[model samples]
Target: MEVRRRDPCQSVQNFSSSSAPYHTIFVFLIPLLVGVIEINNVQNRSKSLIETHLMSMCLFLLAILIYAFAYFAAMKSELQVFKAIEMISGSLCSVSLVSIILPRPYGHFSFIIWAFVLLLVAYKESFHMKIWQFWNRFGGNNQQLLPTKCVVGCPAYP
Candidate 1:
């Protein structure tokens, strides 16, 4: 008997089934990894600060773009919800990028802006409400931590 290959959709299903845990880990790790890579690139003298930063920004943006497309293709039915998350995350990333791209006075605030962007990135990809809930625990319903429409397609929402 010949062995058969597993269906690709099955793998996608498995990956999407418990995306929160992975998203939580990835959200915390990607920025650290990007920082490390940027430091190493600078130390190696492989690229100037501007070059490395631009490269890093492009890579991060590409990652977001790829994930959005793949997620849409995989889920195939949550277009509206995905669009909302995309808008939120994309806007945050754009603001952070702008802060860094502009001249000194504004660039000085890049780190703070980028930090928020990273958090929003995590929220968009993971839809991990626990992170949001953790921050909002002092008051308000955790149920309302994110807009209902923003989480409509999220596995964690239900």
Candidate 2:
């Protein structure tokens, strides 16, 4: 297989039982939330809300990147799979941003789109169980159907 890392995880502890959500949020999400709050604070102070919001959005993108990087480092995941997932998710998200939930970045080009995709991948990995994990657990592919090469009574084809 053309891959770099192993499956999801040997144990669920890898995702959920880190015992320190505070640390995770502190190191990653808090700065992001704070930057947003700062933009609000700026708006409250009668400064340019648009400019602050833009800057806050940029900061949020940075925070997402930071969190994705941290998740990659901590999770011992395959970079190849992560890259593929990020690319596909980014494309799909852009489509949704364009077609349905049109966000600002969809209207305008922004790295925020990619950063959102990275966040999505990171958040998904936090679930611990993977597609392969579920499939294997459920014995999903036990039966196989083969096409018959012969219509009536060809021994070799049958």
lDDT of 2 by residue, 37-149 (tens): 55546646765434535544454455456545545544455444543443343333333223222344553444456557557756897543464355435543322332223
Clashing residue pairs found in predicted model 1: none
Model 1 segments beyond 4 Å from truth? 1-56, 63-75, 79-84, 114-158
Which run of 10 residues does model 1 get worst, by summed lDDT?
13-22
Task: Estimate the TM-score for candidate 1.
Answer: 0.28
Worst 10 residues of 2 by lDDT: 93-102
- Per-residue alpha-carbon lDDT of candidate 1 for residues 43-149, written as tens digits (9 for 90 to 100): 46855655646644664577567556644543554344554454444444444444434565765476566677667765675555664455446433333533334
State model 2's lDDT.
0.43
Which model scores highest in TM-score? Answer: 1
Clashes of 1: 0
